[model samples]
Target: MANKAVKVGLLGLGTVGGGVARLLMEKRAELSAYLGVDLQLARAVDLEPARAEELGLAPGVFSSDSWSILEDGDIDIVVETVGGLEPARAMVLTALNKGKGVVTANKALLASHGVEIFQTARQQGVGIAFEASVGGGIPLVRSLRDSLAANRVTSCLGILNGTCNFILSRMTAEGAPFDQVLAQAQEKGYAEADPTFDVEGTDTAHKLAIVASLVTGAQPRLDDIPTEGITKITPLDIQFAGEFGFKIKLLAVLNNQGGKVEARVHPALVPHDHLLASVEGPFNALHVNGDWVGQVLLYGQGAGRRPTASAVVGDVLELARDVAAGVPGRVPPLGTQASGGRRLDLAPLDDARCQYYCRFAALDQPGVLASVARELGSFNISIEKVTQKGRQEAGPVPIVMLTHEAREADLRGALKKIDALPEIVEPTVVIRMA
Candidate 1:
């Protein structure tokens, strides 16, 4: 059996899929040598027939039908890079039921339907490896599941989306507006044509839900997380953040409070000297705090063809080793066996307490500052620092304030009242402090 080849079928021939195929084909000899068995790319399935010619796959290996690989008894593992919900979800379930080990980079599928997926794998006695799902080549899932297994993880803060990070980084460095930097990002292929998922914080939220599920052993619904995008972030806010000794970043945060979890994604003002603040461009960083291990920072190129493909192949090799050894479920997919059944109590955002950076555009009139402050005071929100910019004789000016720790509900209440005042012209912008 040691001499037998562990066959793999790849679904999708897009950017990530092409990279996976190239890595498997190019590194075939080395991988087979390392695993002590032939790791072969048995089939590659895609809708476009031209992709097969483009990737230069072996004549019999490329097919338009996914079932050719899924139904093939010889194939031991199926790697799904076809993102989004519909067919990817259906294909993954079918692969697991067939008792074939699966490796995928579909974070959205996992985030939304992970419990069902994990349960299927467990019942089938086959493993599902997703090392590339979250932090690309950073080895985040394996680290959290294996390296930090002994510790009770208390918190995890991450710069999870590379597109958002890239846009924000350019905005900070060039002092450009969001639209300008986003346009540049699309031109450079750092963002998708429709960047809603990344910019709207849904992508980051998906990753956060996965990470939080690993920590809490319960999968939280994607809709439950309070997510705020960076589209509203302006150069003015970025400048104000810098003035306050901070940098603005789209952050995914998960805090385990006595078994209850707080999962949120938003633009947070991180301290200038912090590790996460320094992570610029398309890079991603995750700061995980464990009860026993304290704090650990993981940084790397979060997403790309090479980095993500490297992670996908790593999972393939790991599963290949198990397949060769005739041990399919050697390691639990989520590091622990309690994942599918455990329930996590997710705390609402209203209960969350944190410092805030608030910007109010109000008319340059006397009593404006006091009126805003009095509203905040009534709701038990206290300002630690305040600055007013652009003294206009007939127009609204920016009034920025940094407040001490306050409950989210109170802050929202205060802001609601403050915005209704006659002196206030535009809605207040509020960003939480990390």
Candidate 2:
């Protein structure tokens, strides 16, 4: 029989999109031989036509109108690297509805409107592969969906955002303030000019929602996840964390608590010996705990053109093989049958229990520690260690404390009462312990 021909259409020609195009075109012969199908880069759509010239794509391959690719009957798969909700979502849905397979790295779109997209793909009997959405080239989604499918995943703790991880790692290494490190990250292209999503924990939360949904078979609302950023972390906090034998990281935490799932993103204090503590600088790590697998750590470059494109192309080839065989939906978008797994409820943040690192700026008075301790004790929060460093004759001094495991509600209540005290000068800084 003649080898089936599978054509791929690219929706964007930006950094990641360009990489995907280059790979698909450069490795066409090898890919075709591997899959026993003629894998072709059929069409590329981007607002900037100059991108095609820059990438040296053939004359007829580039088009300004997206409909050329979307409406093209020969294209068997659509690769959407357009990173947003509006046009990308609409375009992806259109492709799936047309029975064309999809490959995307849009974490935000997947996290926000995944149910509708997955349903559309399922109804059309096509597939949607999104390996690059979460951990760049780490293969995390596939590992969770295929490799660890036999094990019941109990928890997932990840350093999901490369921008945030870079900032935090710099802060820890140089003892620089948050603002300075963030500025450096932006200058180095690690962060955006307006990095609200990455710095404020929203980016990590989006990735967490996707991973949690895959683990529990329930689509979690992005707003439901409590997100905390690294904006307030200072050099003093990093120094104090080191003194306590811990390193600070912005972590995306997802735990399957009985039938309820706990999801949150925030700066966390990880012990020095823990594997996650060693993950630094534009790197990503996911520590997944499964009943049978015990503990699995998937670590790699979280983002960038080549790494992200590597994942996107891998998904393209996988979906291409299925397309060539005329067998779509061989594997569901999220790894499980849409209606197969039980939906898990989201656990409230208030009920979360963990040790905490609290920093208080208070008047350099002898009675300040006693007053703060009394308030924390009132909420049933016990301190495991306390350190009062440096005395500012006129300004407030630093009081850092490490607390035993306590409910988040009780800790918040204690901090609220303590912040209201006459001796306290600034709001408390709380970093959860892993």
Alpha-carbon lDDT, every model: 0.92, 0.91
Q: Candidate 2 local accuracy as lDDT?
A: 0.91
Tell me, what's the RMSD of every candidate?
A: 1.3, 1.5
What does candidate 1 score on TM? 0.98
Cα lDDT of candidate 1 equals: 0.92
Q: Per-residue alpha-carbon lDDT of model 2 for 145-169, expressed as tens digits?
A: 8899898999899999999999989
Q: Pull out the clashing pairs in model 2.
A: none
lDDT value, residue 333 of candidate 1: 71
Q: Clashing pairs in model 1?
A: none
Best by TM-score: 1
Q: What TM-score does prediction 2 earn?
A: 0.97
Per-candidate TM-scores read 0.98, 0.97
